[model samples]
Target: MIQNIINQNAYTALDQEEYQRRYDSLVERFDTTKADLELTTEQIKDKITRHRNLEIFLGELKNQGNLITKFDPLLWNSLVDYATVFEKQKVEINFNSGITIAVK
Candidate 1:
């Protein structure tokens, strides 16, 4: 939409004061600025979702104050997204919040 406006006004924008002002405003900015904003917005939303999930995970963890000697199925199901077993005694654990840990 904005690009369309810029394109349609390109002809009359030349040799005009308002157009020159508009051009000057855009001169300091890159055409890809919109894409940059979209990327960062996605990142921020992902981070927010992860943080909320982490909060729930932490709340459940707070119940286990002492050292956890036994495995908790609830914690595992809540925190783990998936696990992949590899050759040579290696396993990769993927968390629900986009984090991975490898164990050997």
Candidate 2:
């Protein structure tokens, strides 16, 4: 959009004062849009990194065989961040990549 606006040379068709106002507004909008795009890109990269890390952790856990059969410190430390016990009926397991699973 910014490139198209610049290529059109639309601002020059207006009077000096109007052209200045329009140009400034367009530039401001372009800057704001650019910043928003950069922020979105950064967020996407962070999500991808977190997903990759989770995959690697899962792979490591898979190599250890059945987790429910025995209590292994290394596997627990790598896969589960923490556990929340709710009364006597429910438990919440928080995984390393911010996923929580509830067991009842």
Candidate 3:
């Protein structure tokens, strides 16, 4: 889209200033739109990586049998990433599967 706008053929116009104004406006739009596209593409790629990590983690968990009755340090290490504690007893626990839980 940006390239097509930039490479478009131009014909003689009665108003040269008007043509320049429109062309400059298109150039500005092209820059901003290209930046936005790049940002969104990176976000999508990150989400895809996060999702695959979650799928693999869950599959391993599913094969580990029934509920656990004892404290398992290895399991805990595999599941939790880090935790954030805020004021007033508010805490956020981040998991290995890109999920977070807030406790208040």
Off by over 4 Å in 2: 1-14, 68-95, 99-104
lDDT of 3 by residue, 10-95 (tens): 43433657656777888899899999999999999988977877776677678778887778676676678899999999999998
Write down the worst ten-residue block by lDDT for model 2: 5-14
> How does residue 36 of candidate 2 score in lDDT?
100
Q: Write the per-residue lDDT of candidate 2 for residues 8-102, one digit (tens) a residue.
A: 56554646676567678989998999999999999999899788877877787778776568787876777788999999899999987888999
TM-score of each: 0.62, 0.58, 0.61
Model 1, range 19-84, lDDT digits (tens) per residue? 656766675465578778999999999999889888989988898898778899998988999999
By TM-score, is 1 or 3 better? 1
Report the C-alpha displacement of residue 14, candidate 2, in angstroms. Answer: 4.6
**Which regions in candidate 1 have their CA more than 4 angstroms from the true location?**
1-31
Candidate 2 vs candidate 3: the lDDT winner is 2
For each candidate in the order shown, give its overall lDDT on alpha carbons: 0.82, 0.80, 0.77
Give per-residue lDDT, candidate 2, residue 84: 93
User: Which candidate has the top score in lDDT?
Assistant: 1
The better candidate by lDDT, 1 or 2, is: 1
For each candidate, C-alpha RMSD in Å? 5.3, 4.7, 3.9
Poorest 10 consecutive residues of model 3 by lDDT? 5-14
Q: Give the TM-score of candidate 1.
A: 0.62
